[model samples]
Target: MKLIIGLGNPGKNYDRTRHNIGFMCIDALAEKWNVTLSESKFKGMYTVVHRPEGKVMLLKPLTYMNLSGECVRPIMDYFDIDVEDIIVIYDDLDLETGKLRLRQKGSAGGHNGIKSLIQHIGTQEFKRIRVGISRPPAGMKVPDYVLSKFSKEEEPVIEQAIEKVVQACEASLSKKFIDVMNEFN
Candidate 1:
């Protein structure tokens, strides 16, 4: 089985914010796969989809950003999932807006959510797809920028990026992750 996790704060206020892009892509994937995250476990909302390739779990952690591993580790253990069979989707401040960078392993690069996951999961070698939210503007605080909604001009670009992320995830279900990274990165 494959466990796909999307990291974000859980609340309506966080909806569509730059920090919630992971949740946004997971929501889109759920819709495309005709499954709802109707099951709750380990402080996460999730559902299992039986695809032609295999079983897939789509999860959105409810433990907020900074403590996301408090939710992910237990579910992974309960389900007997290996680190190699998981993929985490989250936002990144380093790349240009709407860009994506996929890696098999890496440091969190100062993302609290990824740092939590790395700490709890005890590995830096898990798969990740980082969606770029861009850096904060001059004089803007990182927290303020990440929690803010996209500007009117950026909406279209972000929407396209989310769609591409969904597609890349779907591709990973059937192809090797390295191939998916090469094709989508």
Candidate 2:
């Protein structure tokens, strides 16, 4: 089984915030595939969907962002999945808005969630699909800015970006990481 995990904080308040875009993309994928994240183990919400290629389990870590690795390791061990079969989608403050980047492995680049995952998994070899959230305007605190919801004007663009990421993910699952980068990066 392939595991596609999206990182974000759980609960109502964090629902539509900028930091929750990863959750939003996974939610979209679940809806598109007509699957439900009904399972409640490994500290996450997940569902196994039978796509044409094979079974894909969509997971949203319930460890609430920073401690997300704890939620993924057990699941990875349970499934005997290699780092190659896993993909993580999350927000990236370093990239520009609406831009996406695909990498087979890399440093977390200061993302707490990815940092934790690297620490627990003992490697940075898993694939990452980073969606740009852009850095905050000058004078704004990074945490406060990321925790905030997008402005109405930014919603359309975000929606499009999510769509692109979803498509990129599907391509990655089938064609390969290099193909996804060529097509979406």
Candidate 3:
């Protein structure tokens, strides 16, 4: 089965934060597929769904962003999932807000959560879905920007991004990552 992991911190206050876009995307997917994320395992929340191709696991890691690898590695070992079958969704500051980029494999590009995953997984040869959150406002610390909740003006744009991200997840499962990138990138 393919593993879809959304990266984010775990807390009520973090629900709508910029850093939690990954979690938000997974939340939308769970809703669409009638899957519940309450089944906690593998250092995350997940649900099993059977699609035409096969069974799949939609996961939202609760490793709070930086130590995501700690959570993902054990699950990968337990399931014996190949790197190619893993897809991680997380926020990116390098691209414009609402932009989405999927890479089959590459460096973590300075993302701590991803960095952790790469270190633990012992490779960067895994798929990734990066949703841009845009650079933080000038003068603010990077961490401050990510942990802060979205502003009122950003709500609509972010909500729309979430919808697209959910669709991207579906597309990834459908084995249409290239098309998804073409449409959303």
Candidate 4:
């Protein structure tokens, strides 16, 4: 089974904020695949989807952004899922808005959520899908920028990125991570 985790803070207050892009992507996937993330466990909300190639557990950590791994580690341990079978999707400030990057393993690049995952999971050998949110403008604080909603001009770009994330998730069900990276990254 594969564990696909989308890292973000929970609740309506965070909705549509740049920092919640991961949650948005997960929501899109749930709508596309007709699965409901109605079950609560492991400090998160999750639903299992059975595909032709394998079973995928879609998770949204309710532990908030900074302590995401607290939610991830337990689910992984309980499910006996290997690091390679895990795919995490989250926002990135390095790339331009709407861009996506895939990596097999790497540092968190200052993302607290990813940092937490790396620390709690005890490894950086998992796959990640980074949806770009772009850097904050001059004089703007990163926290403020991330917590803010996208501008009108950026809405379409973010929407498209979310769609692509859903496609990448579907492709991952049957293809290798590298292949998905080649196709989507």
How do the predictions measure up, each by TM-score? 0.99, 0.98, 0.94, 0.98
Each prediction's number of clashing residue pairs? 0, 0, 0, 0
- Give the residue spans of candidate 1 off by over 4 A: none
Candidate 1 — what's its lDDT? 0.95
lDDT of 2 by residue, 46-148 (tens): 9888888788989999998999999999888987877789999999998887688889899989999999999989999999989888999999999998899
lDDT of 4 by residue, 1-185 (tens): 99889989998999999999999988899998899999899899999988888898999999999999999999999999999899999999999999999899999999999999999999988999999999999999999999999999999999999999999988988888899999998
Model 4 TM: 0.98
Report lDDT (Cα) of residue 120, candidate 4. Answer: 95
lDDT (Cα, tens digit) per residue for candidate 3, span 1-185: 88889999998989888899899888888888887887787678788788887777888888789999988888888878788788898999998887788887889899999999999999998888888889988899999999998888888888888898887777777766667677767
lDDT of 2 at 87: 93
Best by TM-score: 1
Off by over 4 Å in 4: none
Residue ranges of candidate 3 with Cα displaced over 4 Å: none
Determine which window of 10 residues in candidate 2 has minimal summed lDDT.
171-180
- Evaluation by lDDT, superior candidate among 1 and 4: 1
Q: In candidate 3, which residue pairs get closer than 3 Å at backbone N, Cα or C atoms, i.e. clash?
A: none
